[model samples]
Each structure stands twice: as C-alpha cells, then as structure tokens.
Target: MSKDEMADFLRRRRDALSPDQVPATVTHPPGRRARRTPGLRREEVAAAAGVSVSYYERLEQARAPRPSPQVLAALGTALRLTAAEREHLARLAGQVPLGTNAVREPVSADAHRLLDRLGPIPAYLVDERQDIVAWNGAAVVLIIDFGLLPAKERNAVRLALRLRDTLCSAPAGAQGEFIRQSAAQLRAAGARYPADRVLGELVNEFAAHSPDFAASWRDHDVRPLPMLRKHLRHPELGELELERQTLLLPGTDLQLVMYTPDPGSPSAAALARAETHSR
Candidate 1:
C-alpha cells in the first residue's frame, strides 16, 4: 500500500467526522461543540481508537510505515467503519480484497409493474448511489413526492438532506436514526466503489446541501433497508407507522423498498387518506 494513498484516505475520513461521532469529547450527544477545525480533534480520535496521539498522527502523516491488524481494527471501530469500509481499509493496508460488487445493475420492467400493483404501498427502487430509479404513486404520497423533484434530485439521500428541516415531523429520535442510516448506507456504497468519481461528487453535494450529513457520513452507521419499523408524520396525513421491507431483484443491484402497514393498525387506516391527499 502506498503511504500517500493511506494518508489521504485517513485524513479524508478524519475530516468528515464531527465531534459527536468521536466518543472522547467534551460535548454531549447530538449537541455540537464549537471548534476551529471540523471533525474530531486528532487527540480525540487517538483516544477513541486506543492509540497514542503521536502514533495516530504518524499514520496520518505517513511517518509510520504500516499499521498492524489490531491497530486497523481499533481505528475501524473508533471511526465507525461499515463492513465495506473496513474491508476497503484492509485492502489499502495490503490485506486481501473483499470483492465488492454493487454497481452496474439495471432496473427491470417487471419490477416497475410490480410496484404499480402494490396499491397504497409506499415503494421505490434505489441503485447503489441511492438514486430513485423507479417509484410508485403511493411512494410519492407517503414517503416523498418524487414527481415534484428534479430528476437528478430524485434520491432518498438528497431528499433526507434537502428537506432536513421538515423531516423532524417524525419523532426526533426516529428522524435522527433514519438520517444516520441513510448516511451509513451511502458510505457502504462508497467503500464498495472507491474509484467511482460520482460517489465522491455526491458526497460533496451532500456536504453542500445538508449541515448534518458530513458528520453522519463519518459515523459509518450501515443499515440496509427492510427496517423493522418506520414512523413518519406528514403535514396533512398526520401520523404513519410503516414497516419497510427490501426485496432484491435476483442477479441485479437494484433493491425494491416497500412499506407495509400492520393489520388493523392506524397506518392501515391512513392508506385511504394518503391516496386522497396524494390525488
């Protein structure tokens, strides 16, 4: 592994994180501590990773030739690296390749039709970049209005960032969790496709659009969908409790994300209202 590449990667990851993501900090959770530099201080990262400040500094400075497996693991945990990211780190550190494949999947026509048939079910398909390749009418109603957005902005990640202020309509905890998950999943994709310039561009775009995104991206919290429960509140629809599921199309990278309401639940009742409001 080239020391230069390693240094660049380490510095980029370090700069992306905020003080909250680092455990050794003077501030409280979800609260910002004013600092001259963005991301966790080097000493904070060193403390959290269980390494000496000098050692971590050398790694970032390319003075330390190579890090041991144990040190790598410690850094991964401290940085909240996703599986993909950890694997990428290992590869960069002269370890085995994890063989990630997530790009180049094409959406099928059958999948589009299937989404149409699932009436009142909020569903959409996202590629590796989390772009909204296909979304049903119900998805537009309950989840987001894909139709109203610029095609390029038809992305779940972008929606979460661009509409961050309004997204707090859901319980604060749930909203925070979803944002964290979206950031994690996107980072996972970045690890798998490290050379994808578009991913880097999107990351930059996110940084510009949302203040909270860059920090969450560093936390590396990966949660692939099919989440057990998701509760969201709309300006007009009131409250919604939806269970989300992901069905991956075999032999492809595209994923079908569909929401289902519990039988006799309030969300089930909200379906009719969602339909009316959407129309």
Candidate 2:
C-alpha cells in the first residue's frame, strides 16, 4: 500500500468538504477553540468515522499502519465518499483487487466493423474516460464533427463542459441533465483508473473552469449512462429529436453510443434528408 498517496488523497478529500456538509450526528467540543482551517477538524472526522482522534491524525499525517477494511469503510462513510470513491479507497489501501490501472484497450475490430455497418446512424465509440476513439460519418454530420477536432478536444465531457455553446442545442433542462451525467461518469472513471494522469488533468481543468461540472462532481452522483431523448438543432436540418442508446462492447470498456430517430417520425425524415444531402 502506498501510504503517502493514500494520505494525500484523504487530506484533499477532507479539505474539499465544508463543515455544513458533515452529518448532524457529528458534534463539536462544548467549548471549542476558534478553528483555523475551514474543513472539519481531525476530531470531527474521527467522531464521525468512529475512530480515535489520534488514529485519524496518524492517518492524515501518513504515520498510521495499514488500515483494515472495516476502518476504510468507516472512513469512507465519514468522508461522504461515493461508491466509486469508496472502491478507490479500498484499492489504494490494498484491500481490493487492482486491475490494469490507467491502461485503456484499443477499439476492437468487431466494433469498427459494427460502426461501419450502422450506416447513416449517428454512432461513435468512447473510452471509459469518455474520450472519443472512433466515429462514423453520420456522427460527424449530426453531432459535432469529431473528425475536425484535435484528439485532445474529442472527449464527450470536455466538449459538454467547455464547448457547450457550440456543440449543444438542447433545452436548458436537457442540457443541464446531460452535463450532470457527464460529470458523474467522469468521476466514476477517475475512481476506476486513479493512476490515469490524463483523466486527473481533465477533471482539474473542468473543475477549474466549469462551475456546473464542479458542483455535479461534488455531489458524488454515480449514474450509468441511460438511454434518453436528446433535442438537437442542426444548421441544415432545423430541429431534430433523437433517442440515444448506449451499447457496451463485450469484454471491453468501450461504449458504443448511437442516436436513432423513431421510425416514421419527422426526425427520421430529417435524417434521411441529411443522408441524401451528403450524397
């Protein structure tokens, strides 16, 4: 177990929280001195985690022994960690199995063939981190043109947070929901691959610049990508409504996302028109 990294993670998570966020069950000293740091005191965390103050202090100071699984679970609850965060904590403490950290598999040949055969449907592939790996032509025409973007800028979360004005054309509520889900997915990916420096940098960048993303991330919501309706406006096609479906390629972390228009709906006609226009 890397005590130093674990200690740093614990310290950062603690510092990020405000006093008001702590549970009501945690109480302060009857005549507490004025606090210097804004976050919870060591005693407060200890009280909430059901650990001794000295033990928690040793943990934060990186002087403690390897924490037991029970201790880790208690600490996770005390710190209000998400499911992903709790699992990450266990992995860091050497209590859980650690898989290939930060290593992403390439898109399989079968996935590439499927993408090709799904002609005129807006379909694309994204890695666990939501980075665009490959996209079909229909995705380029309907969604943001992935082919035109630099590889670094092709991430779904980054585009939603940083370039929403240019890439999003949905109602305010739909847009908000989309962004929230993106942030939550990114948070899950961060926990799953804690050693992924690129994911770390992307999170830092989004949290630094996007208040909406930062707030959603802090809520610790871990939601699977759901099949949902998306309202989009195209310069050429006017307004279109489509349903987005997510398909996980078996044995891989890649997600195949496809947008489909309901049969016989106006959206279908619009897509047909778009397809013909490209010919």
Candidate 3:
C-alpha cells in the first residue's frame, strides 16, 4: 500500500490509454503546435473526472494525499477502468485491503468424498492457483500422463502451456488457444487473489513464452469455464474429441474439471475403449 507505488500504477494506467479513448476530439490546425503528450493530457482527465487539475496532477505525482472514494470512482469512470482495475485502484488508494486466502485450506473430507463419487469421469480438483490438488484415476488417463510429469509441473495450466509443446504434436494454433484460455482463467483468479505468488508466476511465465497468452491477458477477458470441445491426439488412443466442464467446489477456491466425450461419436467409443484398457 505504498503511495509511490499507487502513483506509479495510476500514471502507467493513464499512459496506457489512447487519446481516442478519452472524450476529446483530435485535430491539427495549420501553423499550430501538435500535441506532444503520449496519452490524454492531465488537465483534460482532471476536467472529465471533476477534480482540480492541480490536485489531479499531484495525485498522479504522489504528492496529493489519499483520494476520497468519490474521487476514486470519478477517476475510474473517466479512465474507463475495468472492474479488476477499479479494485486494484481501490486497494492502492488504501480504501480497503484486498482479502486473502480465498482458496479454502484443508479441503474438507466431504469434498474429497464428492470427488471420489465422480468416478469413471475424468475429474480433478484444482486450487485457485490451478494446482492439481487431487484427481480421480480417470482424470489421469484422459489428460496428461501425470505419473510422468514432474511434481512441480503438475499444474493444469502450466502443463497445457509447457508440456504440450514437448509431449504432444498438437497444432500450434490449438496449443496457442489452449494457453490463451488458461491465461484468462489465471487472470480471473488473479483479480480475486492478487497476492498469490504462484498465480503471478504462472501468468508471467505464460506471457513471456506465448504471444497469444500475452495478448489475451492484456484483453482482461474473464470467463468461468464453459463447455470446451478439445481436439486431442493421444499417443495410446490415437485421436479424440472431449468436452471439458469446470465445476466450483462450494465453500472452497477449488474447481472440479471433468472431461467427457460427446455421445454417439467415435471419440466416445474410443474413450470407452481407453477406459477398458486403463482398467
């Protein structure tokens, strides 16, 4: 909650917005000076936000004292901030400390029983950070060869991004799309638990390694898991189409993801054959 850090963040946010995003019209007059600033001028933003230009400047400079909630809201609106950005701004302004431990600890016995009950479906539990906290036997068969992957890289998102490159000859586009979706999930989780180091590192690594991931992360698209049809070529099973569903484990920051084959499809038949082989 450092004021300097807040000021820096605000300035970066302001600089990131294009002039067109603001209300002002851009025009060039003959023999007149062209605008030299990168983003909307501070005065224009102050005017739109209904604050004194000097005060706004000082706030951006970290010289003004803490901003009031009303002022924060006005600024947020003027800047067209997203919900996540608005929350970050609120935390920075000392309006409230961001909550922590959103992922419930020591997942209850009942939850474990529920996961066990989901037998025969490729079901697994993931913490808010996307770590594989637990999984049913069927899950191991449908997804990665979990026994082969190292312990540290067992995270679903990480495996989808990094291991896919090595383990599967997936098309670049499919792999890229998978990384994009995983990054979006990570970002949504991040908005809720900003201080989670593991989440932050996963985001950084994916953004660094994948252009699609970096772009999607910047777009700030947050979506809970919708049914996703994945095209996968399993070494043992050949090819299969699977639908993935993510279910929230109530009272915990955990998700239960299960993969099922579409009914009446060859992929469904293949899954049945694979299940038999697994047993």
Candidate 4:
C-alpha cells in the first residue's frame, strides 16, 4: 500500500477506537470529553496495545516501523479490529502484501448454468464491488425494478436503499440495515483489493451519497449478513417475507445471494404464481 493509503487506514482505525474500549475511565465530565474527538487518545490506545505512546503516534503518523507480531496482536485487540481489519493492518505494515488488484474472473460457465437452474429461487451474482453481474428470473420478481437502476447504481445494497427512498418514500429500516451490513463485507473485501479502481469508486460513491453508508463504513464493520427475515413489497406479489442466504464463491471475490419464501406464507404462494407466469 502507498504511504498515503496506509496513513488513511491508520487514521480510520484509530478514530474507531474509544477510551472506554482501552480501559481508560473518563475522569472529566462526560459530554465535554466524550464529544472532544471520535477515538481514544494516543497514550490511552498505546497503553492498551502495550506499546509506547511515541511509537504508536509514529505509526499513526505513517512513520515506517517494523512492528512485531506481538505488537500487532496487541494493537488489534486495543482497536477492536475485526478479522479483516487486522489483516489489513498487517498488509499495510508490510507484514503481509495483498496481491494484485484484479476483478476476479467471471463465474465459470457451469456456475452460470447452475444459477440459471436455480430459477424461481431469486438468485443473483455479485462481484466484490456489489455489481449485479447476473441474476435469475426469480430475482427479477423479488427485487423491484432492479433492471431499471442505472448500470452504475445496480449494486444490491445501493438498489435496496435507493429503491426504498424512491418508491417507499421511507428508509428501508430493516432492509436498509441489512444492506449496510453487506456493505461492510464489501469493504472488508476492499482491503484485499486496495488498488481496484472500480471497488474504490463504489466505496467512494456510498460514502458520498448515503449517511448510513458513511456511518457503517467508518465502523469497520465486517461480517456477512447472517440469515434474516426480509419484508419486500412487490407490485405483483403484494407484500412478501423471505429468508435471505448468501454464499461466497471460492477463490474469488464473488457472492451468490438467494432468497426463499417462508413456508405456507402468502409470499410463497405469490412466488409460485409469479414463477408460473414467468414460464
């Protein structure tokens, strides 16, 4: 990583930590001190990470230092680094080198066929940047006018949020939360592809357009969206509830997301009807 890039990462990581997180009890009045700055003080964080305050300050200042694995571990703990963030810090420090920035090769022909075969299940393929590279028929029915989204804005998370604002006239609430969670996973993938221009642009766009996106992005939140109930309103299907599943493609920064309706629910019955019509 370039020095500027490394510096940016360090600053982000530091700003994410809190005084209480580092075992520092706030002696001063609450609101005044708490609102002073976003993250823990350098000395407090350094003490928590078992490093000298000067050394930690130097690290944050982009001064090159060969940090021992032990020190890295302590810093990781002190900063509450997620697995991806910890790995990113290592990469930035030269302890590890994230390889080339390449858009992963397109899904295999067989994988494409398999995705097609999963019709009526609402499956779609997304690259690390969350671009909707492909999708099945059922996906079309479940998501509202996804094809209508501009190519630049076709990202699953982006679509979910923008569509909510445009059509529903209210924030997507739980759906928005779910998309933000997915964006965090995408951000983690970004650490591995720091030089990817497309990925970089997507991150920048979210940071610019969406406050929720910006907030979650800062938190360094990195976790795949676990199974969750999603409420979606489809013109044809009316209102539907579905369970979402996300599967990561091996050896690539691709993800396959599929939605299945709840058993014996109105949504399931509507899905069956839509599938028949689609055929």
Candidate 5:
C-alpha cells in the first residue's frame, strides 16, 4: 500500500478508540474545555509514542521520517493496537524489521566532530538509504534545513524525488544524475537487506509517484560515489557552483557530504556573503 493508504489507515485506527481509552481524554488540564474532537487527539498519540506532537502529526501526514522500532512499539501500546494492528502500523510507518541481523548504527562521535570542524563548509550525513541522519548548522543554512523537516521528509531521496526541494530546482544535470544514483543506491540496499521494510516502502512509493526514478530503475544504472560538481540557485544567494565530495565513514553505513566552492569562483563569494545571513 502507498503512504496515502498508511495515513488514512492510521486516522481510522485513531478514531476507533473510545474517549475513556486515552489518557488525555481522562486527565484534562485544570478548567480546560472538554475536547471538541472525537477519538484520541494527536497529542494523545504523540505522548504515547514519546515523540513531539508535531512529529506525530507529520507521521499521520506521511511527511516525517519512519519511526524506529522502539517508537513503533510505544505507539502500538499507546493506541491499544492489537498484534495485527501493530503489524499494520509497522507496514504503514515503513519500519518493519529488516532481517535477523538488521542493525541501525548511530551517527558516530567522530562523524559529528568532523562536521563541526568543517567550518564555513556546508556538510551533512546520510545513511545507506539516504536518510539525513546528521547535519551541521552550515548545512541547515545552506541546505533546506532538514533538521526542521518532518521525520519522513528527512530522507534525501524523498526530498529530491517527491517533495520538490529547492536544491533540486537548479537548472543542471546534477539533480537528474542524483536521481539515477539514488536508484542505484536503493537497489544496492535492497540486495543487501531484502527484508528492509523501510527500503521496500520507499521503493514502492517512488515507483508509484516519481516517473524519473522509475525510468532510472528501468535503465538499471549503477554508479559509485564520485566527485561531482553541482550548481545551485538560491533565492538569497543567487548562483552557486560547488564541488560535492562524499567521504564514507569507516565502520558505518553513513557518508559525509561536503559542498565546497572552488577557489576564486563566483560561488566562493556568494557563500561568503551568505554566511553572514546564515543561522
């Protein structure tokens, strides 16, 4: 099923609960008005999932990142979801177990330190599936601030392919090439971890929604991480031509990407000017 199906199914499940079954329904803030909406409110589910209210809403909207297994378990318990309902929730969230040895590595401390030291350079980290795991302040200001995005929107693949991120709006072959690389990386992940529910859901969603991605897959293109040049047109910074470098972190599936302007290029001046305006 598509993310649309997942969203609708989650809404229906949330509505099925009686008012008494939810904690928020039972305990009201002093002298607050009775809840106007029927069924468990969004806050109720978020509290149960141990995530922020906005994050949970994004999940229902299918715009956030997939929840981890622990968060899913909390959500299942909070919603009073049965065993079958839990399985359905897993499928909807794109968080079904990958396999027996499936393990998600945390962003290493060294990765964090490296990004921090790459001053004035826009750098961010991505997982094997293109999930934006970590990013620096420069990354946020230069890029689209993936930190502020909903969990589901944190994936580079989703943002570039489906969500129409501004970075991809540049008039260059870079975005098109990125799409092809994305397809190849996804294919690699699927081969290595066939039971990865997250990858499965992502591929299904892309196959249904993105014609370019579908075409890339149909062509069976594969490319390794290479030093590629990208041009970006920012509303605030004008034209930027930067060299993209990908460094694979040892002992993890994470890759650090840094965008550096060539010396004496117009992009260098633009980046310097934009730095003053950056967060």
Candidate 6:
C-alpha cells in the first residue's frame, strides 16, 4: 500500500470540506472549541467516523496500520466521499476487487449512428463531467450550436452556471431548478473523479465567478441527471417544451440525452419545422 499517497488523499479530502457541509446527523463534540483553520477538525472527523482522533491523525500521518474495510467505509461516509472516491481509497489501502477509475469514455461509433437516426429529436452525448462530446443536427437547431463553442466551454454545467441567460430560455423557476440539478450533478462528479484536472478546474472557476453555483455545490447534494421537462428557446420557433430522456450507456460514463416533445403537441410540430429548416 502507498501509505503516503493514501495519507495525502485523506488529508486533501478532509481539508476540501467545510463543517457546515457535513451531514446534519453527525454530532459534534459538546462545547468544542472554535477551529482556527478551514474544514472539519481531526476530532470532528473521528467523531463522525466513530474513531479516535489519534487514530485518524495516525492515518493522516501515514503511521497507522492498514485500515479495515469497515473503517474505510466509516471514513468514506464521514468525509462524504462518493462511490468512485471510496473505491479509490480502498485501492490505495491495497484492497483488491476494486472498480476501474476510468472517466470520459470515448463516444462510440454506434452512439454516433444512433444520434443520426434520431432525426428531429434534439440529442447529444455527455461525459460524466457533463461535457458535450457530440450532438446531432437537431440538437444544433434546438439547443445552441455546440460546434460554434470552444471545446472547454462545451460543458453543460459550466455553460448553465456561467451563461444561464444566454443558454437557457426556460422560465425563471424552471431555469433555477435546472441550475440546481446541474450543480448537484457536478458535485457528485467532483467527488467521483477527484483527480480529474479539467473537472476540478471547472469547479474552481465557477466557485470564483459564480456565487449561486458555489452555494449549490456547498449543499452537497448528489443526484443523477434525471429525466426533466425543459423549456428551450429557438430563435425562429420561439419556446418549446421538451421532455429530456437520459440513457446511461452500459459500462460507461457516457449519457445519451435526448429532448423530445409530446406527440401531436405544438412543440412537436415546432420541432419538426426546426428539423426541416436544419435539413
């Protein structure tokens, strides 16, 4: 086991978190002294993980024995580690049967073909970090022309958080909800792929530039990008109500996200017209 690496990982994860972000169920010590530094103190983490402060300190200092699976699990929960982060921690402690840590699986030829066959449906592909990897012609018509943007700005969360007025035409309430969900998904991704440099940079960028996004991230909510009813604006078509269907490709982090309007509805007709114009 790489004790030094594990210790560093543990310390970084602990330092990244703030006390208010900790789960409410964790009980802080009675009359605990104020912390001079940021993040949960060693004693607070130990209390949350049901361990002694000295033991956690030893783990942080790379001087402790190999942690058991149970203790690791406790530490994961205490530190609010996501599934991917927990698996990474276990692997660092010499645990076998660990899952792969791959991120941003390449979009397959088959996936590309499927998007082409979708016709007027606004469809695109997103990696775990919600970066738009590919899209169909219909997506260009209905959503923004992703091809026009630089690759770094092609991320859904980054665009939504930084350019809501320009990217989203949904009603104010729905737009807010969409931003909230996007932030939550980003938080989960940040936990799952803590070593992803680009993802970390995106988070840091928004944290500096976007107060609402930073606030939402601090909530520590994690959820899959679920099926959502969204209102999108088209320059020629005005507004269209589209229901989003997300398909997580098996054995990969790629998500096939498509927006479809209800059959026989005005939005559907509008989408057909938009599709024709694109053709």
User: TM-score of each candidate?
Assistant: 0.65, 0.68, 0.67, 0.78, 0.60, 0.66
Off by over 4 Å in 2: 1-94, 99-101
Clashing pairs in 1: none
Per-residue alpha-carbon lDDT of model 5 for 64-163, expressed as tens digits?
A: 7767889888887877876655765675566664432247877778888998888778889888778889988777767787867898889877877653
Error of 4 at 114 (Å): 3.2
| RMSD (Å) per prediction | 7.4, 5.2, 4.9, 4.3, 18.8, 6.1
Among residues 3 or more apart in sequence or in different chains, the pairs in candidate 6 whose N, CA or C atoms overlap within 3 Å are none
Residue-by-residue lDDT tens digits, candidate 1, 96-202: 54334455645678988999888888889988777889988888877677878788988877886666566443555665666666676666666656677777788
Give the per-residue lDDT of model 2 (tens digit) for 178-277: 7677787776676667677878788888778777778887765565666868887777777889988878777777888898999998988988777667
Off by over 4 Å in 3: 2-49, 52-65, 75-85, 99-104, 117-120, 145-150, 166-171, 184-208, 211-229
Each candidate: how many clashes?
0, 0, 0, 0, 4, 0
Q: Supply the global lDDT for candidate 4.
A: 0.73
Q: Rate the local accuracy (lDDT) of all candidates.
A: 0.72, 0.78, 0.72, 0.73, 0.72, 0.77
lDDT of 3 by residue, 1-279 (tens): 547756766676677677787764322324536679787677667877899999998987889998999999999887778776776677767787665546458767887787767655677778877788777667777776676767677798777766574446345466666666677677667756667786788888878877888887775545444566677777667777777778786667788888788778887787667666777
Q: Candidate 6 residues 1-279, lDDT tens each?
A: 668768877887888788888765453555756578988777778888999899999999999999999999999999989876686677678764432344445788999999999999999998877889999999888768899999988987776665566656567666666666667667655555556777767777876766666766665445455778888765678878988888877887788889999999999999888898888
| Winner by lDDT between candidate 4 and candidate 1 | 4
- lDDT value for model 3: 0.72
- Using TM-score as the measure, the top candidate is 4
**Per-residue CA lDDT of candidate 4, range 124-206, in tens?**
88887788887878888777546776778778777866777433422357665775776687677777777777777777877
* Of 5 and 6, the candidate ranking higher by lDDT: 6
